[model samples]
Target: MRFAAALTAGAALIAAILSPETALAAEAHELPGAAMSLWWVLPFAGLLLCIATGPLLFHHAWEHHYGKIAAFWAALVIGPLAIAFGIPSATQAVLHALLTEYMSFIILLFALFTISGGIFVAGNIHGTPLVNAGLLLGGAVLASVIGTTGASMILIRPLIRANDNRRFNAHVVIFFIFLVSNIGGSLTPLGDPPLFVGFLRGVDFFWTTVHLLPETLFVAGVVLAVFLAIDIILHHREEGAPKIKDPTPDTKVRIRGLANIPLLAGVIAAILISAAWKPGVSFAFQGVSLELQNLVRDAAIMILAFTSLVVSPKEFRGANAFSWGPIAEVAKLFASIFICIVPVVAILRAGLDGALAPLVLLVSSPTGAPDNLAYFWLTGALSSFLDNAPTYLVFFELAGGDPQHLMTELASTLAAISAGAVFMGANTYVGNAPNFMVYAIARHRGIKMPSFFGYMAWSGAVLIPTFLLAGFLFFR
Candidate 1:
C-alpha cells in the first residue's frame, strides 16, 4: 500500500511538471489572505496532532497507514480551498508548496542522510563522564557541517556502544538530542531546516553563523555543563555493580567510508555555489518559479548522494545500519505538511488584519514594534509541535520579510527567532525530525527510552530554565 501511494504521488508530480496549464498567467490572482478565516488552519493543526498521538495511541495502525492519514488531512484543506477559491488557485497553491519548498527540503535531507549513513565509526571507547561529554561536544560541532541528521547518525551508534556497559544511560541519549540534534545546529543554515528556509528566502548563508554565535555558545555551553553534571552522578551510581560485557570493546578508533568525506564536502560546496552563482534566470511553471541556481544545487546534491552509494563499500552502510525507512518516512510526512501548511502560511502572512490577528498582537510591543522576546517564545513554542521550518517562516514574515533589513537593523530579532526554533525543538521527540529518529534508534538498541510526555518532563526540568535565563540575558 505504501509503495502504491508513493508511485501515485510520483506520477502526480510528473504530470504536474509536464502540464502546460502550470504556466503562470500574466495577471495571477492570489488567494486573498484577508478573505480566509482561522478555520482554514484546522487541517494543518489536525495533521500535526495526528502525528503527535498516532505512534503512542495506535502504533500498529499508524505505522501501516500514516501516509493515508496525512493524505486525508491534506485533502480537507485542498478540497475546501478549491471550493472557496476555485480549482486553479488551489492547484497553484499546492504546486507552489511541493515544487518550491518541499522539493529543496527533501533533497537536502536525502543527501545528508545517504552520505552520513555511509560513514561508520569503527570501534568504541568506554563511556566515562569525560568521554561522553567529549563525544557530545564533537558531535555538536559536526552538526553545523554535515547537519543534525548527519551528525546524529554518524555518532549515535558509537556513543551507544561506548555506554552499552553502563546501567543508567538513558540520560545520555536525551542530552544527545538536546545538543547534537537541536541546539548545535543553530550556527549554520545547513545545520537545520528552519535556517535553510531562511537562506532560501534571501537571508545570507553565513548570517546565522555571525548573528547566532553568542546564543549558540551560551546555550550549548550551559547544556554541556548540565550533561556533564548529570552524567557524573549517573556514572557514580553504577560504580560498584558488575559491568556488563562490552560487545565492542575499546579499540583504536578508525573511520570507514572515507570516500564519502569528499562527497559530504561536495554537498556543502554545491550549496555555496548555488547561493553565490546566480545567473538571474528562472523558469516559471504555473506560478511556481524555479531558479537555475537552485535547480543546479538540487541536482548536485542528488549526484553526491549517488556518488556516495557507488563509492562507499556496502559493508560500511551495513555497519552503520543504514536503511531508507527514516528518509522515506520524512519524505511522505513532510510532503503533506508542506501542502497542508499553504493556507496557514497565507493566514499568517495576512498579519494583524487577518484571522491570526491575535498572534500578531501577541508578538508585538505596545509601541507597535516587533517584540524579540515574544518572537522567541512563540516561534519556539510552535516549533516544538509544528515543523520548525514553516514556523520560522511565519514569524520571519511577521517581522517583515526583507532579509536586508533583518540582517542589518533588526538582527537581534532574527537571532531570537533562529534560536527559539532551533533550541526549543528539543522539548519533545517530535519537535525535530532527528529527535524522533534518535529516539527510535535508541529504543531499538535496547535503551529504556522515555515516553513522549516523559521526555517533555526531562526537557521542562533541564531546558526551560536554561532558555529562560538565556532569554533574560540575551533576547530581553
Candidate 2:
C-alpha cells in the first residue's frame, strides 16, 4: 500500500508539473546555473551519502526502504526545482533524464544482468597460483566481451570453488575485484556503465577499445603479477601446514549454458545497431524526445532479456545462484540518482559561468587547457566512492560536451576520464556495482571477505600505487 501510494503521488506530482502547457512554457525559460549555488547540490550529496552509509550502518532498514529513501531525495530535488525554475523547466529536466539517460542506462544493465545470469561456468580446478592467475586473466579478458558483471557472475563461483581448498584465498577475491570487476572493463562500453554512457552520448563504440588499451594492460598486468606473488607465498605456507581435504576436486573445465551466449551476442549487436542505424526519427513526450535507434536498442535489449529467461534452463540460473535483488536495488537507486543529478549536470554544463565555476577552474590550466592529470585523479577519487557513471558524465561535460571535439582534439582527456572512472571503481566495494556483488557472492559461499575498511586497505596498498604508475605513464 505504501509503495502504491508513493508511486501514485509521484505520478501525480509529475503530471501537475509537466502538464503540456507548462512544459511548453518552461522550454522557453531555463534554470540560471550561474545564479545557482553549491547548496543546490546538497540533495545529490545527501543521496550518495545515503547510498554509501546506509547499507553499512543500517543494513535491514536500508535493504527494505532504500527505494523509499531514494524517492524521498528525488522529491526533495524535484519539488524545489519545479518551484524555483517553474514547473515546465523542471518537468523537462526530469523527463529528459527519465526518458533518455536513465531508461537506456537501466535497460542495458538489466539485459546484461539477466542474460549473463543464464550462462553458468560449470567446472572446478585446483587453486594453484598458476591456475588462479589463469582464471583471473581469463575473467579479465572476458569482462570486455561480456561485461564486468557478466564475466564476474559466470566465473566467480568456479573461481571460489577452485579455491575452496586453499587456506589463504581472500586475497584472490580481492584481486579479482581489482582486475575482473574494474580494470578489465576498460576496453569496451559494454564492460562498464561509464563507458556506455559515453557511447550513448556520441563517443564511438570502439573509441575506448583503441584508447584505453595501454592503461588497461598496465593495470591488469601489474595486479595479476601482484596476485601471482601473493598466491605463491600463500601456497608455500599451505604446504608447510596440514593439508586440508579438497572439496570439488579438479576436473577438466567445461562451459555450460551455451544457449545464452548467442543472446549475449544479440545484446551487443543491438547496441551496435543503435549506434550505427540512426534514422533521425524520434518520438516526443511533453518536452522529452526519444530517438529511433535508442528506442530500438532498448526494446531489443528487453526482448533479449525475456528470451534468455524463457529459453535458458531454469536450473542454469539456479546453479548460477541468480536472484533479482541486485538489479532491483540498482533500478530503484539509480532512478532517483538520475533525477537528482539533473541540476548537477546542468551546473556542470554551465562551466565557468555556472555555480561550480570553482570546480571548473580546478581542472583547467592557467592557459585554459584542461589538466589531464587532474581529470584522471579527480574523476578517479570521486569514482572511488560515488558511482562511476555519473562521475564520468560530470567530468565529460566539464571537459566540454562536444563529442567531436573531445574525440578529435582532447582525446587524451577523454581517455583519462574513462580510465579513471572504470579502473578506480575497484577502490571500494561500493565503488562499482559488480564489486559488491562479487563480494556478496564470495561471502555467501563462506569466504572470509574483508570488512569494508579492510578491503579498502587492500586496495590502498596494491591498487593506489599501480594507478599512480599507470597515470604517470599514460595520462601524463
Model 1: per-residue lDDT, tens digit, 12-123?
5533432223334212456666667666777788887787778789989988899899998887777666545657788888998898788987897789788888888888
Per-model TM against the reference: 0.88, 0.85
List model 2 lDDT by residue over 186-295, tens digit each: 99988998998899799998999999998889889999999999999999999999887887755677777788899988988888788779788999887788898989
On TM-score, the leading prediction is 1
Model 1 whole-model lDDT (C-alpha atoms): 0.84
List pairs with backbone clashes in candidate 1. Answer: 22-286, 23-286
Query: Candidate 1 has what TM-score?
Result: 0.88
All models: lDDT?
0.84, 0.83
Tell me how many clashing residue pairs each candidate has.
Answer: 2, 0
Cα lDDT for residue 365, model 1? 94
Model 2 lDDT at residue 262: 93
